[model samples]
Target: MFRLAHISDVHLGPLPAVTYRDLASKRVVGYVNWQRNRRRHMVDALTDTLVADLKASEPGHIAVTGDLVNLALDGEIELARLWLETLGPPHDVSLVPGNHDAYVPGAFGKACRSWSAWMSGDGEEGPVSRDTFPYLRVRENIALIGVSTARATAPFMASGFFREGQAARLEKILEETAGRGLCRVVMIHHPPVRGAVSQHKRLFGVGRFQKAMRRCGAELILHGHSHLPSLYHLDGAGGKIPVVGVAAAGQAPGGSHPAAQYNLLDIDGGKGDWRIRLTRRGLTGTALPLADLEAVELSGKAAAFVRN
Candidate 1:
């Protein structure tokens, strides 16, 4: 069995000193929000503990679904790179960006340059950029596809975009990977399903995303932006595709949002008969140890899938 651990929205804390120039644009609003609200709930110590527990599980691979930084500051981006190293080497960890990573017009590009190693596809070399989306990485019988929905938005807006160009490319990748009999696992920063988040934070062009999936299909879908543990399904050509979201990895216990958590997926079997067991583990409270909260067994073919 291949054990894949999923974590997202670390939002590495202890905000690095920000210069006046750093907050010239949309970042000013983000900076104020972090200081007034975010810093209190998203703790670095909590994130550290969660990462330690995740490493102990010894999964075959790890998937990080973005929002690694709070303000997309240069310092924060560098700090996040160091944090990613602690999780695992680039080859063992795959990442996609979130809206906060692209908080400003040029911030996303900087993040892509710094975190390229963990986002590049197998055998992809040289400087990686924003255009390198829908990248493919093959591990054992699984095909991990990284899609980028992250984009810069106006102040107070936290939306993602799924353009037609990326959608077309994704469909091709899904079809090709499915033909290889590999379990296709698509990773995006935003939940593709509608109503996953509020209007200002929703994923725009979701119809294009759904259309692509319905044509080619995927074994499993993982996302992060909502910072809430959620499970939704999409109608795919083969069957129902499972789309899942997890809480922020740095969220403190007893926060307004769900506490920090990660999903451990055990994947076994082959193409048409794949079995995925999702085990969610995280902090229940400030005094308790990280523990398993729930488990659900999912099947590649939706008709035979079971939920509990």
Candidate 2:
């Protein structure tokens, strides 16, 4: 079995000193919110403990579904680059940015440059200067597809966007990978089903996303902008595509949101048939080991929701 771990919305913190210029735009409100409330909830200590436990399990590959920084400050991007190295080398980890990672007009480019190695395509001959998704990383028998729904918006907006061009390219990638009998797993920052999140925080291209999947097909989908642990499925041409949303990896317990958690997926089989076992390890009051959480098995090709 190929063991893969999924974590998202790390939101690395302790805001670096900001100049009036840095907070001159919509970021000023974000800075105020961070000082007033976010500092209390999203703590680095919680993230440190979670990372230690995550590394101990030692999965073959890790998928980080973004929000690595809060305000997308220049310093935050650099700090997050170091943080990504601590997770694992670029080859071992695949990442897609979330809304927070794209939190301003020009911050997305900086974030991409900092995390480029972790987001490159397997076919690339050399290192990428900037990230262009949906990038494909074909590992073992699984095709890891990284899509970006991360886009900066105005104040009070936490939305994501995936344009038509990206959708068309993603469909082609899905077709090629599926034809190779690989389990195609698409990772993005925003949920891609109707009613997955509030309107303001939703993926504007959910309809386009579903349309692309309906045309092609993928075995699984993973996203993290909502900061909630949720499971939704799409009836794809090949079978049901499972779309899962993970809570913020650094979030503490007993708040309006769920505690920090991550999912480990054990996938096996090939071609027309694939089997997957999902294990969710998380922190309630204290952190739990991998064996502590219940495991759900996805057996047979089309029956993704079956717990078995």
Candidate 3:
């Protein structure tokens, strides 16, 4: 059995500073307004609450899908590192980058150039350089495949790609590791399977990406970008693989809604079968299971959703 804590879209910061472009369409002119007008202080309180809750519910591993920073500011990256440190250590935590983490060309360039130096710390092991793609982490019975989809998106295009090269590398890695029979968990910033928001630029190559995952079996696909909690069951070439999406860690709900959110995936094995307990962050600080959320589960996976 493996317990994993999944979080995303922290958007760490020294708030109320800079006019930066967002990964989505259009230039966001008001960082100050976003912080002041949108109940940003609620987000801060939610962050502190979430962190405290994570400490109480300790998990074997932590997976952060992306958007650790708002503007990709250097200072914000450091702030992100501090936030990760709070989880435990880099070895205990795994991460991929989101579009917001590399909102512009320069941020990607910097991350590529100093990939190791930037993420340097005690007990942290990962791709030492930008050239290293399809980074695989094998821990206990879990095999985590972390991919980089953070790129300099165009003005109107928020999509991401692994391209042919990265995709081929991933295939080889999966083929090699399949015989191990470990639970394969794939982490990416963008959601691959289609949804109401699938037509957006953030999922440009979603069809191709889904095809690739089907070719090389994936147990669970975890991602963040839409800021809404989602779980989709992909019924195709590889039986049923679930794609779980988490909301922004600290972004306040636009109206009367939850201020913070996360996902807790509890997997237990018995009689050689695996059962998953999927919980969504609720508005009243309750961890609501998908079985109770007929509106959220929306598909075949709902039958398998367990309340815990």
Candidate 4:
């Protein structure tokens, strides 16, 4: 089985000393929000502990969905580069950006530059940049596709959008990859399912995404934005496509949200005969290091099963 670990919204922090210039744009609002709430919930110490446990498990590949930096500050993105190092080399880890990574226009560019290695496509020869999307990375019997819905928005908005270009390209990628008989897993930072999240944080073109997958279906999808462990399905070429979401990897206990958590997907089989399973692991209580939250066999085709 190809073992993969999934985590998101680590929101790594210990905000660097910021000058007024850094907060001139939309960051001013984000800065205020960080001081008020984000700082409390997103704890780097907790993130380190959780990642330590994850590394001990030695997952074959790691998928960190997004929000590695809380404010997308210049310093934060740089820090994220170092954080990416602690995880492993680019080839071992796959990542996608989140709204915070694109908190502002320039910050998004910075993040792209800093994390390009983690997003480069398979056999990519050119200098990797943000312009490339629907990047394909083939691992064993699975084809991991990365999509970017990350974009800067006005204050109080955490929405994501998938343009027609990405939608069309993604459809083509899915169609071509499936012909090769690989289990396709699409990764984005936002939930692409309708009604999966609240209005302000919703993906604007979820229908366009669903439409693409409907025409050229995939085996699974992974996303992070809601800060909750969520599992949903969408009808695909042969059966239902599983869309899974994970809560923040750095969030501490004592809040409306759960403690730092992540998912382990055990995938085996090939093409139409794939057998996939999931294990949810996270901090169970204040003193608990890491505990298995749930485990179950996912439907090879359509039906269902999951714990928490």
Give the per-residue lDDT of model 4 (tens digit) for 1-308: 89989999988888999899888888899899889888898888888888888888888899889888878888899999999999889998999999999998877888888899998898886665556887999988889999999999998899999989999889889999999999888999999988888999999898999889888999889999989888888878777888888879988888778889998888899878888787888988786679888876765655456455
RMSD to true structure for each model, in Å: 1.8, 2.3, 4.8, 1.3
Which should have the higher TM-score, number 2 or number 3? 2
The lDDT for every candidate, in the order shown, is 0.90, 0.84, 0.64, 0.87
Tens digits of lDDT, candidate 1, 51-101? 899999999999999899988999999999998898899999999999988
* Candidate number achieving the greatest lDDT relative to the actual structure: 1
Taking the tens digit of each residue's C-alpha lDDT, what string does model 3 give over 227-308?
7777776653446778888767775645443446777777665322446666665344443221222123222335444443
Error of 4 at 31 (Å): 1.2
lDDT, candidate 3, at 116? 41
Where does model 2 exceed 4 Å of error? 125-131, 286-291, 300-308
Give the range where candidate 1 is weakest over 10 consecutive residues by summed lDDT.
299-308
Candidate 1: list runs displaced more than 4 Å.
300-308
Predicted structure 4, TM vs. truth: 0.97
Query: Model 4, stretches more than 4 Å misplaced?
Result: 301-308
